[model samples]
Target: MPRQAKSAAAEVRSLREEIERHNYLYYVLDRPEIPDSEYDAKMRRLQKLEAAHPQLADPASPTQRVGAAPREGFGKVLHSVPMLSLDNAMSREETAEFEARIRRFLNHTGPIAYVAEHKLDGVAVELVYEKGLFVQGSTRGDGTTGEDVTANLRTIRSVPLRLRAARSRGLPERLEIRGEVILSKRGFAQVNAQQVERGEPEFMNPRNATGGSLRQLDSRVTASRPIEMFCHSSASLEGLHVSTHWEFLDLCRGLGLRTDRANRRCASLDEVFAYYEATEAKREELPHEIDGVVVKVDSLELQRRLGERDRSPRWAIAWKFKPRQAATRVLDIWPSVGRTGVITPIAALEPRNIGGVTVSNASLHNMDEVERKDIRIGDEVLVERAGDVIPYVLRSFPEKRTGKERKFHMPSACPRCGGRVRREPGEVYYRCLNVACPTKLEGGIKHFAGKHAMDIDGLGDKLVHQLVETGLVKDLAGLYHLELDALVDLERMGEKSARNLLARIERSKQTTLDRLLNGLSIRHVGEATAKALADHFGDIEKVLAAEPDDLLEIRDVGPEVARAIAEFFAEPRNRQQVRRLLDAGVRPAWQPRRGGKLAGKRFLFTGGLAAMSRHEAQARVERLGGAVATSVSKNVDFVVAGEEAGSKLKKARDLGIEMLSEQRFLDLVGDA
Candidate 1:
């Protein structure tokens, strides 16, 4: 080998060693010695050296954690030991019965030591490690065979690429670690935010996001998401013996794999119930979603004695939390128009308490969703807060339907303005094509004056209704042209109140481009997309002039979104309204914002930002000429992590993206 090649190899080795040490400290021990930025620099140096000298790259190298070639499809991999599902104990009585059955099977009367772990709501997978090196990973498909997802799994930072040699003294030659792949609550929100920004449907929950991300054919796509894993059990092990489940978890942790920190050892069933109740009480506080707790016999010998029963182990049981659902009768189904003119079917239900809150109505989403679920007026239905938020109609109880039940049909005409309603080809929603529809006008005007938009205080629903009904305001532009005399004529509008509202309207004139674009209520153009467009074009006139192809050049703008933006700008009426607003002193401030200290940088925020909301943090970044990204990616310059930062932080570490503490971020932006 040439001297230069030898020198490169040595440097790569040194960098890899340092990077691995930091990974162990951060992921396993939760004690990071160096700041994430310094660690990222080291990892980047290793990656650059390996890229220049391909022969120096190793499969187990920390640098290989991401940036793999995309595969055509996943191949099949059979589990050496089937990944069995668990039996559930839905109530305290069922849990007691489970404990009695286990004792009978083991022929023991004394209390059995049990390990309780939160049952993560995610997809299960098996990770195979050879000689302390991660080699393969597969999803738990059918509990027997699974599709290989090794490349995607490698992108998850919590999963070790190579076990710590210092802690691998008693490690097995080959280990198959069984775990759950999950997206934390924060990560799930970020993924959904990006999806919406790209004009794609949002994921229902974190579990769905995890499953979707893990199945991506492109490893780079998976790497861009914030996916994580928590190793809980072993599918197969060789050259190692552990007597207790708790001991095994400790061993897994020592090998530099992450285990849930909330796992506890209970002395008796009473202790188990206590632990379950405690965890259930704080379920909403967990970073990752969990549906229940798994109780397993701590003693491996006792587990063997109790043996397996078909699919589930007899010695373990899942104690599930109460379902967040209630049965209610659908009073009626009605159509409502949104700012985008899509007609959504909403079901007014008999008020029922679900998860301690009364839900009087739930969105049926669309006509297709209503038909698919066969929801009918006056029929009994099961209502649940999907993902513990957003009331959803799960299904209808057809058996309980009465003779008064009526089938619902989509309205052929707009209910509010009598406009013709049409469903676009290849789409599931019915839209009102009339731009002057009263419902759409009111919705758009209200949204324009919303808190996140122009923030015109005192111009609420009642006032907006009076303005539209009195024929004083026809569109968003009309708000800027409202006179105090006309407002004073409306009901309950005194001289002082009218003056205050006018002051707010005048104050809204000097707003940012993003806010103005968002207030326009263009189809598929949300706050995030609006911000991206404002940053990319820097002016409203430039955005209006850009073609669909030009708009597609910006990140997260798909063909659908590009078309929507172009169509919105192409409408003569829309253009006229924008011009009128501009003429009425509604100037969108677009001063060049790309020359600040943080210019041309991208930031991802996770966890609770103490000093401000996530939106406020994002606004700060934009004000400083930096862009806020919804997901972690190679292009991300830094991750501003606050308290309880979750999977995004882990992903940033894996991809060698710089990370900053909230204080450090404040300092960088000169706010400290």
Candidate 2:
């Protein structure tokens, strides 16, 4: 190894130790010697250095943990023991019925004991252990089957790879525990901030973030995500003798696993109801996200007596809190175009608390959302913020609906550009018929300059707005026509900044095909679609000539996406714009072929790699000419199995596809 490489390795080792020590102090001991800002700066430096040199980074390195990259698709993993969904008890009557059912099955005389814990609103995953070592983990895909996400699970520090206590060591030879994986509020905020910095769409809630993180193909990416898990139930077990669910939680804690500390052992349904009431009152005060309370039969023997019903275990019931709803009058409903040109209705509500937050605004989602809720301009309605974050109105109060309240009729023309608006058949959204609507132009420019799209630095939302408002930029192609002087004339655009923006714009003209496709901001054409288009077309002009049918032929491209792509290309004005862009020397980037020995073979990764970051590994494989698939199938040549390899690995084995260890997979890439 080079002297610089050895030094870099040492630096990473030192940083990891320092960070780990700090994490122990902060999270476990609740003490911190270093200031948070200083600690964060050091961590960022470590991340940058490690990202630049992946060879020096270890799997346990503090910089390698958090969230993973998004997967291409999710694969099915048939659980060894099915993960049962919970039965919901919305009222006291329902809870009584659930109790009656248990009594009918068990023929018990005394009151049945129940254990109640907060029902976390997040993705369900099963962690399998063999002799206290995390063997596999998977998502609760379709209850019986789920996607493998073992590599990602290993990245969670709270999840113990080995159980402690000399007597408890390997107490269970085989075990599978079902749990909820949630993104912490702190982690979600930090991740969202990073996303904002990168110009990517923010996840609406922690549940969405957790679900997205678990399915990521790159364990390294999963490691970076702030994911935590709470074991709820035992799906399967061997060599263990716990009689009650409450006792089981004690065992879990003894084995160095995490369980909800808020869980209470209730002797009767009255206690359960009281527990629910208490949690409901304090729900807003809780740091993590909890939708409701899960009440389960405490006795393991009694649970077996209750059994299961179709999709859910009859032994457990979830008492859902009412949707945090409030009565509020709609001030107005306004249309806003998204980056992809999808027009959305935003309801301006009378300032009131819905859920916990004081909500003055809520999304109507689309025309469907508006109509389904029967929302009107001036009518008083009930609005709810599910999980206390996203707000949506339910229905208008008939008594409060005065004759003066106006029915909100969606306009037939683009409000800003006077262009005709059209609603497609069977679709709920109304679109701007004019391709060159200033709203669309503004959105297009923003997408073009976005970090995940064109990555054109110096051109921001304010600058794009200025260019669009001034009529200097009509479309993405108009960016090339900009000069430093034109930019300087805009407010806040200094000479140096203007020159920088122009230079960045000029450089963006030469971006790769995927980036160019993303920059175009076609409806339903997101980052994934853009990559698929680039891989298929290999050039821009060919894509313009292709029909909707041709676009539909690509894997994962739906009819809506195809229609959007075709519509974008069919416009003469759009074609002219493309021509102008092409004429300005924007050449399409080359599509690198899968040329090595594993060229035709598809590989899907699950679980954490002990050595390399997922991004580094993916780049390495792609560089050597290998196709990295998102989901597992029979056609997959190999599944790269890592620590906690989940459902995908099992599916691969079931399909008789070869499975490779992380080290072996790395060796293959190195050979290529």
Candidate 3:
């Protein structure tokens, strides 16, 4: 073997050894001997060397660790152990009934103890360990199945790569713990604020951000994300001596796991409610977002006797906090134009805290919301975020008016660009006429580089902001025009990173029509709309020339949407932008024609489906060329009812719309 080959092999081995050492110290012990930058530099060098000499790279290379990889989509990995959801009880009466049911099942008339804890609003994941070392991890894809996220899971600092158990406690020979991976509300705000400053689209909530981050195929990107986790229960434990759930948690704590300190042992239902109420009040004050509290039977013996329902555990119940509504004065109402040109209203409020987080602003949705609520600039209004995140002003408090409040109206022009803003007929939002407003430009460029859009591998928000602020990128077309040297000159954009980014930028020109359409930031053209458009028009050129009548004829394309598409194409600037995007070689991936299986078949869903959630079911139906209506109309074909079939069931029967049970609905698609 050549001397250089041997030297390169040794270098790769040493880098792996160092990275593993740091991983153990940082991920397992929460201690690091080197700064993050230094560690990253070392990892980068290893990556470059490995890329040059593939034989020298290890499969377990630290460089291989991000959460995404241009996924066609995620596949379900059936869990060896089921991930059961908890039943919920909102009031003391229901809480008492939960306890009584457990007692009845156990046949114990004497007494029982319970454990209460805050239920973190986050994504559920399972960590698998073998012989004291972390081996694999996956998302709770569908309770019984999950997507492999081992690389991304390895990036969370609190998740230990190894477990230690004292022989006395009977540590399992092999172990798997199911838990929630949550982002701190503070962290979410900080990250999104940075993105906002860079003219990038911000996440609506922390859970959405956490979910998107965890699904990234590249571990390096996932590593940079500040994700935290809390273990709730053990899914499977082998060769372990734990006899109860409480004991199991204690053992987890002893192993240096990051468990909640507020988890308490309760003596009665009264005490449980007290804990729940206390947490409910302090929940907003915590650094993280929590929707509610979970109470579980403490004794393992009783839990075993109580067993579980088909979907939820009988041993535990979540007490969800009602949406916290508070009265506040709306000081002003203003519209912020996004990169996509969609104008949205932001309500400036007198400072107040809802669920512990300070509230100064809330989304007014659109012009209709403002008129419906009769919200004036100085009106005292009720705001809420209890079950739904993002505080919303509910209604006006007329009693507090004192004739001092003033009526408010949305602006007829873009505030930033001084351009005309028009609200499409029958649509909720008004849109900015200016295509090059600084914020819009920044947002569009950011979208063009996002994971779901252009997938430009190395262009983060910070870099994109620098480019725009430095006047390097005037529009979306500037991305394609960037030279490697120009990128390399920028801070943080090294030679390799610049080259990789440029390559991705070049490759992105060949992106699908759906991705490009979604990236353009068009009003009402979300991922679904983009997909439909791509399917209707095979390429960007055809889409640009499509007439309103032509578009309205397409499946899922309504008259209003078709008009929006036509209006967008009617603008000369919008046409010029399209030309630039094409000149820059950005290709769009367009899906081929999909048969409309449920065409002319209107569907309504109430409650939840056994095979999928209501939202999931709706999305699946639309994907297969179907329409979901809020109400059962004369044109409706099927109403899929779940376990708790609501008012929609009766209404469906009254309207004579065909109805399907959960099983029947599943069978229609062969999903049962």
Candidate 4:
């Protein structure tokens, strides 16, 4: 079956923006609009889809950073080390998988020790002490640079101004301590009572109140807030004698800094899971909020061996507990149309607080889901932030429902354009069939101009929407007809911007056949399938003329995908649009994958290459039927090393994997 993620490049971009917006809301503003589980779902989905199609990965993606940029009122402080986030494991199965992945990456057969600490649901801040005196502190803003909240952090009495004298372990020349600043349950209640007395809006939760209080411009106001800090992990130790995370925590305690007493050392994966269950069972009894337990490889050497991804560390993971549920009355049920014309049912609920955040809506997904759960308007439904990320209607209580409750029926027409809607055979989704539906049309344009498709640089969502609403362009081919005079007059488009957009549109005419196919908005034809089609057929005309059976002959093309392709080209309207594009001089260059020596091999590169860049290496590999992977695994056939190869080189060597020098790698590709 084809993955639900379509036009990998476009969805990748869309998911990135959505995840980043949530990050800003949760991290910077401290106004968490979604549960942590909900946020994790988006991040995990983005990671999976991006991994499948590595070409769509972006450096600015939420998957590439730990947090959002610092709230802009204060000065910025750069950290000596990047504070990467820990990936989450929702169940023991996922936690076990985390360990299994590490074993494969490290090629280890021995037992791995770990440090399990209570994953604090509080604001994470970094404090630096120079020569035993507190020097500076900041929030973990964007991981590298953070807002300078040194004064406000100082106001918290628990944050030591000077390190306490110790015999065994003296203070390092400089120490960077990472900790969680949390407001106590009692403190939160008292603060809310004060807010009520002062006629001010009370905070939503302890975590929010803690973050908002810490970021206050006035240190005196922050000092008044009853908040404390619990030292957790740190990126830098400076001159400390710590070989393991366990030792580091003990050392931190000895230096008069408070650490979570709930921290446990686990010798194996089973032990980690045991602690996790125990911590979760008694989490409510704790003074502050703790959503999960963080498990990290105890051996610093093992951690070094595991390394990290661009966004999070590989040797550690946050094992989050189950989602929190709340009962809320469904006031209304409505259908919302997506860019792809799929209409999803959403339930507007009487707002209720679940896991410290207020949720007013939950997704019903489709009519099938609604029927399965028996959800209806006026029903008191059980809503859960599934994985703490999305508001989900778990089930509806028909027993508690009044006779006034109504069954929901999907509308015959689209809510956006009031156009005819239909459900295809054996599909769960209902789609708007009208090609000119504003929502669907704009979505198609977005996919067409996406980086994965025609690679039009200056065409953004606003510009695309403007182009559609102004009647400047109705279809993909109409984009080619846009003039600078009209474009310049659109809101926010200067003369320079108009010219740039026109140039980008002109440049898009010269894309590859595979990208052109992906941009066409065919039902299930995404980047991978499009590339396979282009590589197999070698021409746009061949693909257009191919039968469903012919499409099935290509690798990875299933019957459904092949049928979708055949059906797409069979449409007279689609054929005419292709003709219009051709007449507009849009020539998609075709290239066939060469069947050669490198055909079945997978190559991974480490260190620097003198002859060419890593990207050039990938292109050379892919030109043949070979593949390029980002990590060292049993799957990788060759490990190419150059000047100063890092841990991957060591890992590959330890696995007795074949290594090729820069010259040898070049010769292999050159010969092929």
Q: State the lDDT of candidate 4 residue by residue for 178-242, as single tens digits.
A: 99998887787766544432324346567767888888876656766788888988777777777
Give the poorly placed runs of model 3, Cα more than 4 Å off: 1-56, 59-62, 109-111, 130-136, 160-174, 194-200, 216-224, 253-257, 265-278, 326-334, 337-343, 347-361, 364-383, 386-390, 393-412, 420-672
Model 2, C-alpha of 296: deviation from truth (Å): 6.7
What's the TM for model 1? 0.75
lDDT of each: 0.84, 0.76, 0.75, 0.79
Tens-digit per-residue lDDT, 386-464, candidate 1: 4544588999999997688999988899988889999887776788978799778888898899877788888787888
Q: Model 2: what TM-score?
A: 0.52
Residue-wise C-alpha lDDT for candidate 3, range 1-672, written one tens digit per residue: 899779988998898778767765665455789999899879877876787688875435666553334444455678987888888777778888888887777777876788898889889999987866778889998888889888788778677665656436645678888888988877787656544433344565788789987887666557767888888788787877676677777777656456766788888878888998889777757878887888988888777777778878889999877767788888988887776576878899999987567899998766777787788888888887743357878788777777877776667778877788887676556778676776678778887678777777767768877898777899888888899878888888789888887888888887887888878766556666788777655567667766565566565565766777788789888789889888776666554436556533447788777877675576556656665666555545689888898888998899888889888787775531
TM-score, ranked from best to worst: 1, 2, 3, 4
Task: Tell me which of candidates 2 and 4 scores higher on TM-score.
Answer: 2
| Best lDDT among the predictions, by candidate number | 1
Which tens-of-lDDT digit does each residue in 1-672 have in candidate 2?
Answer: 998778888887787778766664454334678999778867876886787787775655665455455566655678987777787888878988988888877788788899999999889989988886777788888887788777788788766554544244446888898888898777777665545323344566788888877777776557757788888788777888889999988777766577878899999999988998999988877878888899999999888877788878889988888767898889999887654445668889999975558999888767766777778888898887765356767787767776777767667877778788777786656778776688878877877789978788877678788899998887777888888788889999899988887788778777788887877766667677888877655567657766565666565686766887898888888788778888887876845564645543456789989888776676566556555666665445678888998887777888898888887897888744
Candidate 3 vs. true structure, TM-score: 0.51
- In Å, residue 605's CA in model 2 sits off its true spot by 29
| Clashing residue pair totals per candidate (backbone < 3 A) | 0, 16, 26, 7
- Candidate 1, residue 257: lDDT: 90
User: All candidates: CA RMSD in angstroms?
Assistant: 11.5, 14.4, 20.9, 22.7
- State the weakest 10-residue window (summed lDDT) of model 2: 192-201
TM of each candidate vs. truth = 0.75, 0.52, 0.51, 0.44
